[model samples]
Target: MHLESVVCFFAILSLGSIATADPNPNQTGSGKQLYRNRHVARQQLLSTTTRSVPPTQPHVTPAPTFTPTTTGSSTPLAPAAYTLSNGEAAIAIIGATYAAGIGGAVLMIGGTAHPLAAGMIARITGGGPNGDTPEVEIEDSNPVTTTSSSASSSSSAEPTPIPSPYIILFSPNATAQEIQSVNSTLVNHAAPNSLSEVVSHGTGLVVFFKAGINPNQADAIRQAPGVGGVFLDETLGVDQLPSSEQAPLSFASRRSIDTDTPGSPKASVRNPADIKLQSDAVNSLKVISQPAGAKLTELPGYGYAEEAGKGVTIYVIDTGVNAINPEWSSMPGHKDILYAPGAAKTKKDFLNHGSCVASKAGGPVYGTAKNADMVVVKVPRHLHTSAVFTAILEVSNDIFKKKLKGKAVINMSLGHLIPDELHSAYEQLLDSLTAMDVVIVTASGNDAEKGVNDVTHYPALLGPTTDIIVVGAVDNAGYRAPFSQGSGIQLNVSAPGYVDCANGKAHPDTQGRWGTSFAAPAVAGVIAVWLSQDEYKAKLQVEGQVAARVKKMVQDLAYSRVEGQPPVIWNGIDPRGLSCASDHPTGFIKVFEKDGVASGYYDVSSNSTTGGVTENIEQWCLAKCTGPCVSVFLYRIRQSASDGYYICNQYNQPWTNNLVQTGVAAADSGVVFTKSLNRRYCNSPGKTVSRAS
Candidate 1:
């Protein structure tokens, strides 16, 4: 028993030496001794059982020294490693074993167990196959706060695009099915509520894209069936320039010659004996009738047809018209003023431009065709291409529905520069309207100051076409206005641009407005007057013979004023014949005379019995009358005939016989001598007339 005890004691001493042994003999003794002292303290505090095991080198390299951070600094502390005594290392293994056993119990108790505990056990136990030491990585636990600079840098990765509007025009021959298909494609690719039909006559549409369109999407649309062209929808402005004050008298004061003032002469006096003196104002109205170099005193007042545009309608496609103004209110009925679809409901002229335009066309005091009807088609202040297209379509449809084809005239005092494709679309729409015998008159745009040629402006650009009559501006002296755009070839006619027009304020107030906007309306009024005549109306009703004749007549009768300017528009009256007593009487008067010798009378039945012959009665009288002719009468012997026959008599003296005595004799003899049928002419109020029987 004594010998066994001595061997066991030796073994115990050997095991103690191994537990306290230092594996790295080359390592600094101070670090090893400090680590062992800390392990001993930790082992006493844990109070866990320990087992002997051989020490191994750590798998990871030794980390740098850890430096604690201050409160103001956010730098994380570096991870560190330390050597442990054999006994303390054994105690760590035993604690890890206990944790593994508890984790197994948790797994058996509940199915929702975390894998973190198992993962820790695997990391602690699973070293290299060659028996290398395991490592425990300690990541910095401080929460990180993001900076604004980094956030901004991350946010600026992508960019957004802007939207734009475009117009899609279909081919003229494109079928309705094809148009529908193209529209469907646009709706699929375009932004919501962005597609709209602009002009049904030209088959055009407008669409907007909020997110902007890519090249691929545009190409797809272009490749669609029946798509003629796509163009950017551009905005336009009114054609009027800035207003100026240049009138000598107000509209009310200029309306009549103040008879109360007698010799004071508030206004110029028109020749009472000379018929066709419509207005007393010797301003723009007088100049239209006089020749280029005539003195202001020699100028006659405005001369127009007897019908005075009675059957014609002037469509003023502009801003809007104030129907309540005296210029329009004085007419028989206020019902002549009309608004196009999509135009504003308000009758007030916001810009006061359309009212002035309307006044120059057919106002009671300052107009050309004093009795013509006016239709106001309103547009936005800043005109859009789509809005213009829609307006034109509305006008065309209205005229066709009301059967006011040739009797209608559209006066467009607005224009803008447009693209080629858009120009084509306009041409298509206008061509259609003109085919129906609707005359279109437009202003030569007021873009001369901008160096823009009148031919470059739309509607005016289409002036070269026979159906459209484009007028440029000329001052009162018959010289082209400084701002008037166009060469003589580009413009169809010229008219007084500077004129005393309605100010669109209160009733009877006037302003001296200047621009081609005023000139075009005057020409429109003249066309209205010409159309009111029976001969032109008959020509309009004939198939294939449209407004071309009317357009030619206007151009042919226009007289040359300034050398470089277009011929100024005339009211189709010869100033030389104003005081004449030819067969073409000036006013609405009739005369019938029977010579005592029957051989002196010339029968005109073989020439022309149509009512149209009355327009050229002077020429017929000159050709058919044999001897010295004093008076000519148009008579239809047959009561059933639709037109009258001309009878030129050589009676040079006036006869004083009552019409009732002639009618009673004609009824008893079975011969009907109707009242003399001469072309009716307009006369001023309270004019004396002398009829022969």
Candidate 2:
């Protein structure tokens, strides 16, 4: 359908449905009839007011030029009187009036007093008690219609008459000359076709005919040899476009702000193998956890204590960081920060969201990795997925061209649900970046309502890949924040997303903000610290193995606690687990569960390596116990061969590595039995051994 027709159809439909409660009894006609009459009168007014152009010539709108203006608030224009057609008096009302609240009065317009139409009075009064009052009372229950011609002129008038342009799509092989030839032949010599200066290259051409395209003409154009398809050229005004592209940013004053002095990391670094929990949340635990209630400085290594993130470049794809501020400028590697060429250098964060996130990642006082350098890629404050995709591609291309693959980590705390068509392109771009060994971290989104219902947010949903880490927000008590959106296989971890905006130097604003947005940067900063480590860099140098092991390494070191389910607290920088690990399946475990007993088959080759390869599990259990108790099959995989794997009881208590054997069941006579392929052979898997049933 044509856009004009569609709009008109909706307008008509809307006008016909206009209803009000307790309409004025004095009203002359139904709203629909009155509105139709007003519309007709408006059409007459437009015909008399507008200047007509030559019918044969195609009208072209000039490109608009914008002049920057000082930012300030302005008062709105008040409604004024306008003369109606048929030389009738039209009283202009500034606001609203109701029937019970309004009474008939002399409507003075142009030095003359005229009695108001019942329709006009009913519209203005909105079925209220009569009284002598000029004051407009706009009730929430019933809206009053102001009879200001200037206000309703545009809405009531008919759209301008113009020949609708057609977008003709040509086959790929069709040349420009052939398209032009077809265009020329489509219209007669007297009525030439008006082709747009902007060509669709090998695809299509926008053509407009003076006489307008009839059904026969359209059919003929469609049947043309190289023409693939034809569509209406639905055009919009420059003003109708999204304001993000048109608006100019007004940056904060260029003055250096206070810098956050660096602090020391935790005294001892923890090893991943020491952590035994394997819940989804455990993948993101830090050694010195961000305390349930503690300042950024108080949290263990929260202030980039680990390697200062040196040699690691954090590509922050956000509202560009306000590096002009001393908090960023005072940093050791602040000089490394960059904005895309030709991008506005107003090193001030207008939205403050970017600066806040950047601080969490690398700002000296507020950051997790104070020493890590950052590339601030300024995007629109209100991000569009396409703009984000473009920015990522550009940054990724730069990283590849400059050979900064494993040396960098990309922090994208912004994303939205996009169309299905864009998903493939978006994922492809991410795959390309990850394939280059760049670590990607993104938020699970703040839309918890949508998330609980299984609405997956993108980029976070882009993978089953280990290269990208999807983080969600967790509270001080280590439970998913009520506002955080995440639950499922895609959620890689959770972190302390809470930040007191009032306390931090990076965000100089009123109150604070929370969500997965803040949580993502915390993870990114830790990755930056990991990247800066000498050992991790050495592992990066040998092929792309390090990128594949990042997820497992994170899970191993994660500090886990069970809420409804376990929530992992993302503490900053665990240097212990940043080792090269392979994905070879080295061993298997057989799970045996009956009654209240939940135990898994645990066996491995004597030579099988620990912490790197996948440990498979085989399950065999009685049908009754298998239904509920077997649902949770968790067996601790110990580092020492002597520490045999054990299972959690029906009570969900932590089981001892070896002594917690022969579990008790809730029902009498239902014996809970547990066994494993002796811990001695686990560390060095000599051969695959079968467990005796």
For lDDT, the strongest prediction is: 1
Clashes of 1: 0
Task: Please give, for residues 141-216, the per-residue lDDT of candidate 2 as tens digits.
Answer: 1123333232232233222223344444454355556565455543321122343222321123321122233232
For model 1, the stretches where C-alpha displacement exceeds 4 angstroms are 1-163, 198-216, 237-240, 243-276, 291-296, 333-343, 447-456, 537-545, 562-565, 574-693
Q: Candidate 1 lDDT, tens digit per residue, 260-358?
A: 111111123222232344424446776666543445455444555555576788988776777667566644312354444334577776566677888
Off by over 4 Å in 2: 1-306, 335-345, 381-386, 449-455, 501-511, 538-542, 562-566, 569-693
lDDT of 1 at 141: 13
- Superposition TM-score, candidate 2 onto the true structure: 0.42
Clashing pairs in 1: none
Residue 228 lDDT (model 2): 51
